[model samples]
Target: MSVPAADRGATTVAERAVRRIAERAATEALPPGEVLAARGAAAVRGRRARVSVAVTLPYPTVLDDAGERVRSHVADRTAGLTGLVVPSARVRVRALRVREPKQGAEAAAPVARAGRGRSGAGRPWSQRRVPAAVSAFGCAAVCGAFLYDVVRVHAVGRPPARWRARLMEWLVTHGPDSGVWPGLVSAGAVFLLGVWLLVLALTPGRRRLLPMAAPAEGVRAVLDRRAVSALLRDAVAEVPGITRVRVRVGRRGARVRARLGFGGLESARRAVTEACEEALGACGLARPSRLRARVRTDPLWRAPTPPGANTGSGPAGSPASPSPTPDATTATTATTATTATTATTQGSSRA
Candidate 1:
């Protein structure tokens, strides 16, 4: 094979330059900033080529007490020095050159420190105000409704007879009553209101009890098993041709079995199967694959009326509908026997 001229040149200039730089970096233990500058200079002059570059090791920070500790020591020593900023600079181990530190290095450090550090004092208007406003408006509306109810019952109308009569009689018969009961009742009412308001304030999402609006994530309500089962039964009953319906909940999900009771096995299976599929479709599951149906057993199938028992018909009743092919019968029998055995073993274990 012939060698390419470009490959020959790469070996001569780029390979030797990279080797020299790596050797110098290893020997001098040069700081990362100087090393980076050297690498940049190499690329500009076409002395070396880097196909892949990544920091294999991280230098220590002031917060970190382990590692070689030399990086931090160097950073601290050079923090206030002139012409280069070293504290924030990472220790990159590539190419190397040494130049005298510049005159502005010390000033550069503090300015870089202030400019680079993160501060949470001011965020964008959307984050700071929108969520807070939404939560506040929701809470206020709930409180306003409760307060309106209170005012409507007490301050705006004639008080109910029992309490009103007693209060009036007491005020007329006994001049200005004095007791702790009223004060205690007032305090309890205030405490209850405060507790309720606090709960409303801390609660998330919009309040549905009163009319106010805010963008809400989602609304949820509890649908207990009894409610779900009742709904399923009602829906199935409405299917025009279905009778003799049965539902069973199993580990695999839910199994609904139904049959037309009076129809042929095939017809009953068709109607019940379609109804089940339609009912499940309305539930909107993640995928159609999640829902399935099968006709286990239908009571409507009859043993084909004995051959020649009826007045001459077209086929005179074929022999019990031709007992399923021998292979099919054997396979079915084996499956049933296996299933029964497994169930028996499981039941014995439970017992």
Candidate 2:
């Protein structure tokens, strides 16, 4: 096998890096000294990138103008930092605020931005944010404690806090083997935590949303896996023979299963594949998903006939035409079968 020239010198940018760059760019794009907060998410393929940014704006700012600046700046900064061709950035105005208002105190109402993180693809840090935020909070708490103690001792000449005194006393009295079982348990916990963090760092996060190419200028978006599945099913339903469809979308591709109601099995299978592929293309994913469609004819289900189709007795003495099958759309509404036969009749025929 030979590697392509582009693959030979590939430079892969991390999703986390792109997110930070976008967040910084959004903040910088806003008015000087007016930034509240900005968070971003990104999906990058080769040298092309798609990004989503969510930000808080100060009260009484023109939303359209702020969004425009953010979109342009993020696109520019990401391109500059990672050398990626960013077609567009999806900027979401998450809120309007200089500071969060207290309960019962009226402030400028926060703006609503449609959420995109349900599938975790549009989250600022994917799955890493929670762990990273927790670690940062722990460190900040320690720093805050020291800062408070320093300020108190220097400015007011107060004695050390009782909490700190108790902690020191405990450390002095507690030896490594003081609580044998507890010490071993704590050691094991710390080791497990270290290993988990290491694994998280080495592995890529899973995303349940597909990145979409921008349909319009300066506007990229992502579609959730559920939405993709629903779209594929709807598309398959429109096919001539498809009675039911189940679509599963994963990181690698999409798997589709279709039930053919009444048609040549092979032809229906081909139709299903074509329908799914066409609908997927319309989905606008940055990397079009690999598609696999499986089709089977179902004996229990039937496709509905056209509204004007004739159902009549055969010409002359020919057998009467069978009644047309019930409409699929109306079948579910049926409460029970209408036919019932109970009689003492008995017939024996020899052929």
Task: List clash counts for every candidate, in order.
Answer: 5, 0
- Can you write out model 1's per-residue Cα lDDT over 1-351, one digit (the tens) per residue? 999887775423454444334333322333454323233122213331331111223233222331124334333333332212332323344322334446587556446545533331111122334555775898899788666666767997944456545756765555334444665566678789678656655554231111111111132222223333454556655655556566653322456666543435565556655665665555432223133434444465353354547443347554445446899999999999999999999999999
For all candidates in order, the CA lDDT equals 0.45, 0.75
Worst 10-residue lDDT window, candidate 1? 207-216
What's model 1's lDDT at 307? 58
**Which regions of candidate 1 are displaced past 4 Å?**
1-216, 238-242, 250-252, 284-289, 292-351
Global lDDT for candidate 2? 0.75
Cand. 2 TM to true fold:
0.38
Give the per-residue lDDT digits (tens) of candidate 2, residues 8-74.
Answer: 8767899899988888888898766566446678998887989988888876678888779878988
Model 2 regions lying over 4 Å from their true place: 1-129, 136-188, 198-206, 214-220, 299-351
Most TM-score-accurate candidate: 2
Which 10 successive residues of model 2 have the least lDDT summed?
A: 108-117
